[model samples]
Target: MTQSPYVLVLFYSRHGSVSEMAKHIARGINKVNGMEAMIRQVPDVSDTTKMASPALPENGSPYCTLEELAGCSGLAIGSPSYFGSMAAPLKHFIDQTSTLWMTGQLIDKPACGFTSASTMHGGQEQCIHSMMTPLLHHGMLWLGLPYKNKELISTQSGGTPYGASHLANSTYEISLTSDEKVLCEAQGKRLAETALKLKK
Candidate 1:
């Protein structure tokens, strides 16, 4: 049987905010017929040594593989903010994709980014851009949420034309705002639509 086309919803969430946003994005991706969402996460990296992560995480999403990353019809990558950039774990995973870049396996695929931060101004946009840079290097078409989503104009919390974002606050207790959810779904839908159009 033929495999279904999938949008890889790849993310790393230390406090769970980015993971929640990824679910919303997957919901949006599923809204497009003939497409599916594959949610994956990267393993945490330790500073002490280059110890390998466990084969599977104790809970949450499974670790992403380079093969999976290269095979996706589209991609929605997310990472929690770490000093105005993507978290170390996610960046570590992206760094291993040089082989994919060399082979042009990811070229022309549609991609988008998402991020969550502990504060409203905790550099969410920069984190999204940080995630996009590698995709751009791999020759993927980077996509952003358009202002047409409406949430981009009115969201005081985390929606941006650069990508969907979330403000989890210092306590990390906040759930996604309605505007954030809308924009995430919109980003996923737009990516799926674009990927489908390109496939034809």
Candidate 2:
């Protein structure tokens, strides 16, 4: 039997906001008949002055492996914003994927990014760009939500043409706006469709 095409949804969530966005993206991926969504999370990084994470995650999704990145047909990477950038744990994980980079394992695979921030102007777009850099180095095809998605064009909240985002608010409630949800789904669909076309 032929294998179902899978999109790997990899993210790092400090306060659960980014993880929620990943689920929304997965919903969109599943909407496509021929695609599968594999959701994974990265371990938290400690300072050299502190301890690394335990071998198994104490709670949420399983830790991601380089093999997941190598085998995925498409990718959606997300993280909580850290000073207008992706958080260190996710970046640390990506930094270890040099073997995949050398072999061009991710070349031409469709990829997109999302982020969550604590405030309205928390540099969501910058986080998206930062997440895309390693994917670009691996030669993955970048996917973004198109203006055709009505929510993207009109969203006053966390939706962006770059990718989906959530304004976690001052209290860090982590609720996704309606537009944010739509754009996450749109982004997922876009990446899956692009991967299918590239596979052909």
Candidate 3:
């Protein structure tokens, strides 16, 4: 049996906002026929000495593997905003993909980014751009939400042409707004469609 083409929805979240966004993205990916979404997460990094995280997370998505990253038809990476950049854990995982970069395993694959920040001005766009750097080095095609989405023009919370994003408020209490959710799903569908077209 042939395996279905899948988009790897990879992300890291500290307070669950980004994780929830991943689910909505996956929903949109699945809406595309002949495509599937493979949601994965990276393990947290330690500030001190390197200590291994458990083989599996205590809950939620399993940790992503390099093999899975290489095999995906498309990619969507999400991370929480950390000082206008992606979180350390997700960046650490991306750093491990040098082998994939050397082999050109990710070259030409469509990829997009997403991020959630704790404040309206909490560096959401910056985080998305920061995440794109590694993907660009891997030679993947960068994708961003277009103004055609309409949400990009009207959303005061988190939609951006750079990618999908959400504002969690200072206390991480704000949920994804209707516009933000639409943009997230639209980004996923757009990525899936692009991947499928490229495969042909």
Candidate 4:
């Protein structure tokens, strides 16, 4: 039997906020008829001097495979902002997609980015942009939360035209603002819908 077309919601969440956003995005993708969300996570990487993640993750989604990335109808990349860019693990996974790039496997696929930050000004947009760079280089059509999302205008927390985002403000822990969740869902729905149309 054929598998349903899915939008890959791939992310790296060190502190859990980005993972929450990924779930919300997956919820939105499921709302679209005939589309599904395939949520996956990248394992943390470290240099030889540092310890690496175990072969299996301790929690959350399993590590993503290249075949899954190549087969997806759409893609959403999520990560926590790390000094104005995406976290290292996400970059590491993205860096591995050059084989897909060389094969043109992901060309024309609809794609989007999402991010979280510990502070309000912690470079959410920059992190999303950093995620987008690789997708663009892969020839994927980039999608973003449009102004029509209204959350983009009304949000006091995290939302942007470049992509979905969240302000975690974690002194103790991280969480999404209501507006951030709405925009994330909107971004997911947009990507799924566009991907369906393009698949036809």
Candidate 5:
């Protein structure tokens, strides 16, 4: 029998807000029986240094690779919003995945995105959709939260059709609202189940 595929949860977090959302998604991915979740983070980008990054991260999740993107059954990408767009560091990482896109390795795989911002009106949907563009170009199946997720429609905090999101205040105190958490878990579980079905 073909082995179940792993759903890779890739993201970049500056203030740990987006990292919190990634964890919620991983929690949902873990609910599936056969599928697995792998969490990874990308290194920061800098103008001064194009030489290379350290072999190991100082702390937090390890660096991601194109191999991980190619091997995974599905992808969950997250980023913090920077003026209605994904942060520069996350964009830098995604830009490097063109090699996988060129090989069609990500084709037919299911993918989704999420984001966190420092305000209720901080362009959550825009940020998530921003990350979706490259994945769509890679020919991956895009997964979105359905309206049936009641928390999505009723959320006074942060939740949307694009994906999952959280609202952070000035202090960057990011908490996944109940609605945000539910939607994130739902997104992860949905991706895992879909990956299994596709594998079959």
Candidate 6:
């Protein structure tokens, strides 16, 4: 049977913030009529990752397969900020997509990024850009929240034109503020709308 069209929500979370954002994004994608969201997580990586990390996670979504990734009509990538860039484990998974790139599998697909940071100024925009570069290399069309989204102006915590974001530690916890969550949902909705338009 043919699979229904879905926007792959692929992400990595360390403190659970990014994963939560993926859920919100998926909710937004499901708002579209003919599109859906496929949530997946990348495996953790360490110096001894291959032998040290389990093939399956102890909880949450399973590791993303190349087949799921290549089949998606759209993508929403999320990661936690590490210094001023994406977390290493997510970066490692992105690096492995060379095979997909060579085959042009993701070309013309709509993609967006979201991120979480431990602080208000923890390089959130830069981290989102780090995720965007690889998607650009894969020939995917990128999407970002526009100024038209009122939350982009009223947000006191985290949300950016580059993509959805969250101040993961505002309450000494990993919750997204109201405005941040709104933007995330808006980004997902927009990505879904764009992907459906392009697929035509």
lDDT of 5 by residue, 19-88 (tens): 9999999999999999999999988877853424576878778888888778999999999888999988
- Give the distance in Å from residue 125's predicted Cα in candidate 1 to where it truly belongs: 0.8
TM-score of predicted structure 5: 0.93
Specify the poorest-scoring 10-residue window by lDDT in model 2: 44-53
Q: Name every residue pair that clashes in candidate 3.
A: none
Tens-digit per-residue lDDT, 51-161, candidate 4: 378888898998899999999999999998899899888888888888999999999999999988878899988888899888899999999888988889888888989
Candidate 4 structure lDDT: 0.90
Off by over 4 Å in 1: 48-52
Better of 1 and 2 by lDDT: 1
Badly placed stretches (over 4 Å) of model 5 are: 1-4, 48-53
Model 2 stretches with alpha carbons more than 4 Å out: 1-3, 49-51
For each predicted model, how many residue pairs clash, with residues at least 3 apart or on different chains? Answer: 0, 0, 0, 0, 0, 0
All candidates: CA RMSD (Å)? 1.2, 1.6, 1.3, 1.4, 2.1, 1.4
Specify the highest-lDDT model's number: 3
Q: TM-score of the candidate numbered 4?
A: 0.96
Error of model 6, residue 180, in angstroms: 1.2
**Clashing pairs for predicted structure model 6, backbone only:** none
- Model 5: lowest-lDDT 10 consecutive positions: 46-55
Kindly report the root-mean-square deviation of model 5 from the true structure over all alpha carbons: 2.1
lDDT digits (tens) for residues 138-161 of candidate 1: 999999987889888888888888
For candidate 3, lDDT tens digit of each residue in 1-200? 86689999999988888999999999999999989999999998789625357888999999999999999999999998888999888988898898999999999999999999877788988999999988898899999998899989998888889999998766566479999899999999999999999999
Candidate 2 global TM-score? 0.95
lDDT against the true structure, each candidate? 0.90, 0.87, 0.91, 0.90, 0.87, 0.91
